[model samples]
Target: MRELTESETRVLFEKLSKYIGRNITDLIDRPDEPFCFRLQKDRVYYVSEKLAKLASNVSRDNLLSLGVCMGKFTKSGKFNLHITALDILAQYALWLKPSGEMSYLYGNHVLKAHIQKMSEDCPQHQGVIICSANDQPMGFAVSARAAVECKTLEPTAIVGYHQADLGEYLRGEETLA
Candidate 1:
């Protein structure tokens, strides 16, 4: 594991900013403690400065991973978010109806019929956290329509595009482990 290069940080921040917006500052400069991002293999880990310092003592060959596995960099350089980062990215969310939870867990995109509520100011084509009506985050998605547009759309209209979900824990257990 090593520090991210300047270009790598830029790419990762750009992607994260899309989902979390200004909240990126909260991740980097926490009130409790200092934290940082580290690169291990192709994965980026959100680790604390203290923990990272301790982890650095271990040999690279034996250190499999560090703190939270935020995401990974694709071979082409685009950053792909892992489901593990959902907690940190749970600021803006779209609440789904109880009946629609199963479909999203099955990796299906959220339809207009599934939406129970959402941030009123939510705009179209923006990243949003998909949550259960009870306020549990299910995963990440891109809004298919603006908050106002959903009110006029048919039940079958797409509301959010699925990105990553809890189902991936079962589907990609090997990689996650």
Candidate 2:
């Protein structure tokens, strides 16, 4: 990812703050230095550290990736948000029903009946921070339909897939660390 210009960084932060309902320009732009990085023309990554003094460009394969705390990148350049980084802006979260939570936590898409709650604030098909009925954030999901139509969704209809989940921590991999 390449370092963004000051103007470019401010623009991005403004857009994100609107979506999450807060002016969080300072959240991604540290007081001491910058925290935003351009992953391409349309996508960007936000880390917790100030790396501009060390380097300007950091790609996915670079070892410097260790400094990346979290990020929001575009998907097909349609919208800017990566499903995994949902926790940072989780205030406008979607709370799923128990059944729906189970389906999603296991890597399956969420169904209509599984949706216990969600904010009417979200637009249709937008990436959302998802949580279980208990308020535990499961991960991210693309809204299958708008709030008005969510109730009418078929039980078998898939809402959205998990962009990230805690279950993966115990998957086939074997590690003691």
Put down candidate 1 lDDT per residue, 4-120, tens digits, no spaces.
999999999999977877778899999999899999989999999999999989988899999999999999999999888887777667889999999999999999999998888
After superposing candidate 1 on the true structure, give the runs of residues whose Cα lies further than 4 Å from its correct spot.
Answer: 171-177
**Top-scoring candidate (TM-score):** 1
lDDT of 2 by residue, 50-168 (tens): 55434445444563443433454355323445444556666667888777776777877777777787776566766667887787777766677777777677778766555656566
TM-scores of the models, in the order given: 0.91, 0.59
Q: Model 1: how far is 37 from its true place, Å?
A: 0.6
lDDT (0 to 1) per candidate: 0.90, 0.62
Q: Residue pairs in steric clash, candidate 1?
A: none
